[model samples]
Target: MDPDDGEGLFSDAFPTRELPPASAFPGQDPHALGGARDNILEVAIGREVRSFRNKLGITVADLAAATGLSLGMLSKIENGVTSPSLTTLQTLSRALGVPVTAFFRRFEERREAVFVKAGEGLLIERRGTRAGHQYRLLGHNAGNTGRVVVEPYVITLTEESDVFPLFQHSGLEFIYMLEGEVIYRHADKLYHLTPGDSLFFDADAPHGPDEMRQLPIRFLSIISYAKDEV
Candidate 1:
């Protein structure tokens, strides 16, 4: 309005809007913990960063000074108040003497569960399946993941099934006889497995049913191994 008073003629038309508060982000509320579960990355990253910092015996001020960041910014990062950029994370990683991936190690560690309805297990085939053996996978979807791999199958062998004894694989195997009877083999060992009987052994050695002692044999075949294994 006052063009002659060192002010632009359109100054009043383009008024500066007040800036938002430092603690306020677009969608996140720093005070609300209800939405925390949905923001797992924030919580996990904060926990990891704080834990690493504590282990190194350093204060927020020390980290801020080392990373060339302000104390408020570091506090926000540690408190999960803000989602940090990759550049910021790289800076923190360098100052902490740890890899950037170390911050995510605790993120993927979660409570895992798999539930399958009765008779809803996926029908899968194996070496013995062609010989009339039936294999129903109970929890194959969630299996073979994480630090350990687990596969659970409900195996049924009828009278029409042939006696095959040449199953070999990695990891360890466990068999729990649920119905009928069978003479199981593990390498050179022969075990007469009956109802309520259980067998646990290394899977490295060749193993399978040496003989079906009774018809309609049903058992649980569970195999597990380390994730790092070849």
Candidate 2:
């Protein structure tokens, strides 16, 4: 959707996605939104990667040879089943004449901001249209580049999240707990995190929060930096 063409200089910014539920993260279900968010991001990445390659008339084989990666791996990365390592992504980015970060650019045509009151934040909900998990964009498309975007969100936990394998990339995620408690799963370890506790880690490691508290969990998740070229 397009941002409303009203007001001043930044008026033409890209529009954000629809507002998801704002309810505090329920402890039981957090992974509900993982699949959908992952899917959207995956599709976005796939489209960008393919578009860039197609623009160069570069075939899968051509990319494979240029990047010194296996065609099978490249195919899997593009398909979203697996994320590429930084070195591999850098090679591909160089070959494409764009920054590795270019792959993560979110081409949101519309951008707007939604403010949630202290007691009136919208609930993050799971609808049949998408999957489980709900969120609201903290700011207008502030940081949407595939490599780095500063998105603050109130993530709700409604289900037990599965162990997300490590995501091999170059980025740092800083999460500040605003309310309730959660379990941060990294690799084979689990760390219990509560409100006010901040956690920062590499985006390359497959990591996600597990809602174990009965009360809803809310946090500010920040992707401080991404190493993609674009």
CA lDDT of 153 in candidate 1?
94
Best candidate, lDDT: 1
Give the alpha carbon lDDT tens digit for every residue of 67-166 in model 1.
Answer: 9999999888888788889999999999999999988776776555679998778898787889999999988524434687788999999988998878
* Clash count of each predicted structure: 0, 39
After superposing candidate 1 on the true structure, give the runs of residues whose Cα lies further than 4 Å from its correct spot: 1-95, 99-105, 108-112, 141-147, 226-230
RMSD of each: 26.7, 20.4
For all predicted structures, in order, the TM-scores are: 0.56, 0.37
- Candidate 2: stretches off by over 4 Å: 1-131, 140-148, 159-170, 227-230
lDDT string, candidate 2, 1-230, tens digits = 11122232333352222345767544656546543554365666766778899999989999989888898987887776676677877888898999977988753433445676665544443221133345654543334334455545556545543323333444677778887776665443455677877777766676675335545666776655444422
lDDT of each: 0.81, 0.60
